[model samples]
Target: MSLLAQLNAPFMYLLCGGIILFVALVCVFFMIRAYRAGKAMGIDTTKMKRVITASATFTLLPSIGILLGVIALSGSLGTPWPWLRLSVIGALHYETQVAEAAAEAVGLQSLSASLMTPTAFSTICLLMSVCIMWGMVFSVFFNKRYLRRLGAGSKSGKPGGGFGDRAMTAMFIGLICAYMGSYIGGFVSGNGLFRCAGSWIPLGVVAVACLSMAGFMWLYEKKNAVWVESFSIAGSMILAMAAAVGLSALA
Candidate 1:
């Protein structure tokens, strides 16, 4: 896990993502085969649609959540206001590690060092516990439904690129976001944006990123297209990272 502590962890994550992507394809191939067998067995297919739709639609919010920063960086990009947004998950990952560092330096039992003070710690802990519980339940629900749809039979034929239609879109968005976040992280880190340590940022940047994403969400509401899914998700990741990193830099 020490390897994970380094900012160089992106390379590791990229490698892991590639391996997982391949594994997902293999699983998907078997799923398709089983799904076809279910049809032969005359099983009802309607139940599967809910899981499929949920898989596609659930990401809609978080995608917008990540793009808040990419939009704010518009002026930095020297582009028009409505240019397509990107993501920065690779960079903002520093926060997770930073928290770990602080916790190690000072015991986790010490306190929450954020703006919340003593009371904020409990609220933050409560919120995180809630999210963890929600994710666990959601995972079980989706996994069981998906497995049921795939049927119990095995022995798959040649696998197609059966990645549920969003693989390419997600990969493209992820690769782009990795680069964008790396650049931003490097710039702020090198330039000393957050005092000597890079832990805070100007609120204006946060506001802009939020507003830009909101504007795009509005545009998205007007135009409903599948291709935009990748853009929206990647965009939100970037926006949120930028907001976070920017805040850190300024602080």
Candidate 2:
């Protein structure tokens, strides 16, 4: 390989950044739309900022996890990069006992594929549960925004009557952000003449996240923010899947 090419082993990082940037842009668009809706509904910008920021921070991890998961699904790495696949598969299965029990708590998303086998990219859709779990906490807080807007007053940690709505809204917002962010991530995950640069994903998303939040704040004073769940469960999940793949690079 050429010296220049050698310097950029694993260009997926760039693509990741692009995907993040795109998500932020879309998020801002959605925010403006939501703001308009809020205006029509009398949603206060001051509160909008607070609520959005809170919601974003709460679920940023899951959103990123989902992105990584999607990339994994796409097999954009073609051959699983060098050690990423091995680490992933091995970790998933070795922890089978742990995973099975933990999965029951969240409806049991399939963590069957050990991250060790040949690079086929086939695995269960167990990651969704992770998304839902992280999202649940975020959802709880979101409803508070609505309640506060309705003149219910303010407080945190303690649950309020309108918590459900805020929770649901936060879930919805988280979903949208994750979905939009995926697109941004896609744009910057490779190193080829056409592939995205993975490193760029974090930067792109951060940039977009900052810009979107700023726009919402300036225009309305508001707003809201990993990989796609490691692209599985938790950083802890890395152990089991890594074993399955016969490797443990990031666990």
Candidate 3:
């Protein structure tokens, strides 16, 4: 059997599902433990429930999007790698780029199930894992200190507050610019990168998402609807996905 076929074998799914189940159990254990701790400390259980509801509602959309990403990558890389990466420290935005970079480094233009060999698959997996490990290592060692410093600065409410806000804004802007620039460059270069009709779908999706979010924001301001703010992200995601489908069909 081919490497891709092996990767998609039943054993891989069982292994992936086992790891994911263990992680989920660990997460639930900690959550329940924390809830018990709060109860012992006489924290209001009612307020805690409310907080949990709001947090879960906010997180649901993004988690769905991440699952969609895992599905997308699974078609090419199989289920185990994407499932493991995304279930842990992996960000949705970084997975494709990491795969693409790893593939390029191995003298492949891109990775696909049909074209991949065992050696190439293993190399890409190792490279992507190692590349992300630096961030995980730093977080393990320095995350507490980083949060402490941030808290101290916020309390000061001077250069700390302003600088923190600006820094975060700049960071997000930089990330968006980098993603957008890469797509724009690919389209402009047209070196077979944009040759496929489906290549334009991502651009359409982005535009649709942005426009939907902006429209929701405007409506929120005018109508003073509290739910609009909550649903904005979800609405944009759904509309963007629909737009992608429509655009792909048209193309």
Candidate 4:
């Protein structure tokens, strides 16, 4: 059978659907447990219900981006896998990067459905599933210790009090720089996915995204637009994607 056919097969859908259902059950179980625990702690049931309602309402906005991610990935990787991944532990950026890397490792230029094969698809699925688990595995063993250390540092009021926050910020900055460096390199060397004059598209899209995010943050901080916080990331992503499409057309 064809790669897309295999990807979207009945069994694939069944497997993904089963996994998502299991996750939903686990979430519901935790929700009930938490609700009971809150009552035992003397928290009012009405307040707890309000908190739950607010949490679910806030989740809807971020979920739109996840839904968009699934749509973006579904064109090449198929619907079931993307749906399962994003519904579970996967982020849009991480999934796209890993999938593209896996496809390239298997001699595919991109994650395009037309360029994909069964082997390439398997490679992507394996890599995406396995490679992203290291953080969770480490957390399973060390998260408590890490939290204790972080708490101690905070209590001490020393220069190291902010170490955890600083470390996380540095890591995030490093990741952004890595991606930006690749885009700049591609722009300069003309060695990116688009070797033509369009090699700068990635950089351009990133710039647009950054600007959009900055505008949203300004609105939130300066204008006191409280609702902008939830939409900032999703709004920037949508704008960046639109910019990419426009640039691609121009190219």
Which candidate has the top score in lDDT?
4
Ranking by lDDT: 4, 3, 1, 2
lDDT of 4 at 79: 90
What's the lDDT for candidate 4? 0.85
lDDT of 1 by residue, 132-168 (tens): 3555577677877765565422245324346633676
lDDT of 3 by residue, 1-251 (tens): 86767888988888878888898999999989989989997889986775676577668877988999899989889988898879876889899889988888988877788777788888998888888888869989998889887774355545554566788889999999999877676665546655542256667788999999999999899888756776687778888988888888988
Question: What is the lDDT for 214 in model 4?
Answer: 97
How many clashing residue pairs appear in each of the predictions shown? 21, 83, 0, 0
TM-score, cand. 4: 0.61
lDDT of 2 by residue, 177-203 (tens): 996676566555445434664434443
Give the CA lDDT, 0 to 100, for residue 220 in model 1: 71
The parts of candidate 1 lying over 4 Å away from their true place are 1-26, 34-212, 223-226
- Output the TM-score of candidate 3: 0.64
Candidate of highest TM-score: 3
lDDT of every model, 2 decimals: 0.47, 0.45, 0.81, 0.85
**Comparing 1 and 4 by lDDT, which wins?**
4
